[model samples]
Target: MASRQTRLRVISLYKELHRLGRDYPDPSYNFHGKLRGLFEKNKDLKDEAEIEKAIKLGEYIRNETLALYSLRKYRHLKRMYPAVSPTDPFP
Candidate 1:
């Protein structure tokens, strides 16, 4: 049934979001709590269209979060190991 499919999709999204929350760097930000609150606030949504929209938005957020994390990681690596110039004898 459509409702069952929707339920599965929602659960999948919830699990993915929670997993990402675990990977987030800032514990003080309480990413998991905020993510849970966002879903809880919209738990009563009765319209399939609205639910789909929310799912899309959540996916977008997930992608953006991943990109930002990658960028941060890259910056950290760059700082830890700076580029060596050809003219420099030692790094």
Candidate 2:
């Protein structure tokens, strides 16, 4: 039996990941569905150590996904407003 802390941690992580999926670029890829499936696949873990390890992995994935979204947004903005060269003085 998993401790209450572990259970709460797992639920929160799952919710946060699903929330993050809202901003995912490709709807057809079904990011939320994949996340759900991953959580379901791990629902039978009986060891605290194993659960913690899985939680850590999920956090890592969340951070990476966030970075990816941030990069995409940055690229979009950069394209809209090209950076001016430092050597070029303003008119």
Candidate 3:
């Protein structure tokens, strides 16, 4: 039997992933498909240890996704407004 905390974490992770997926490129196809496939693939996991491992992996993936999004946003901003170098001061 899974603990209440574990179950809640699982639910939270699932919802967060889907929510983030909407912001992901190709949300309708690639992101959703891959997300669904991953959960489905692990649907039958019964061992507590395995489930915990999966949860940890999911958390890691979530963090990575956020990092990627941040990097992409930063790049886009940089492209729009190129950074000024300290050595080259002036408009």
Listed per model in order, the count of residue pairs whose N, CA or C atoms clash below 3 Å is 0, 0, 0
Off by over 4 Å in 2: 85-91
Q: Which ten residues in a row have the lowest lDDT in candidate 2?
A: 82-91
lDDT (10s digit) by residue, model 3, range 1-91: 7788888998899899988888885445688778888888887888899999999999998998899799989889989997788888695
The deviation in Å at residue 2 for candidate 1 is: 5.9
- Best model number under TM-score: 2
List candidate 1 segments past 4 Å from native: 89-91
* Cα-based RMSD of candidate 3: 2.4
Model 1: weakest 10-residue lDDT segment is 1-10
lDDT of 1 by residue, 9-28 (tens): 88898899889888788889
lDDT tens digits by residue: candidate 2, 2-34? 999889989999999999999998889999889
- Of 2 and 3, which scores higher on TM-score? 2
Model 3, residue 19: distance off in Å is 0.8
Which of the two, 1 or 2, has more lDDT? 2
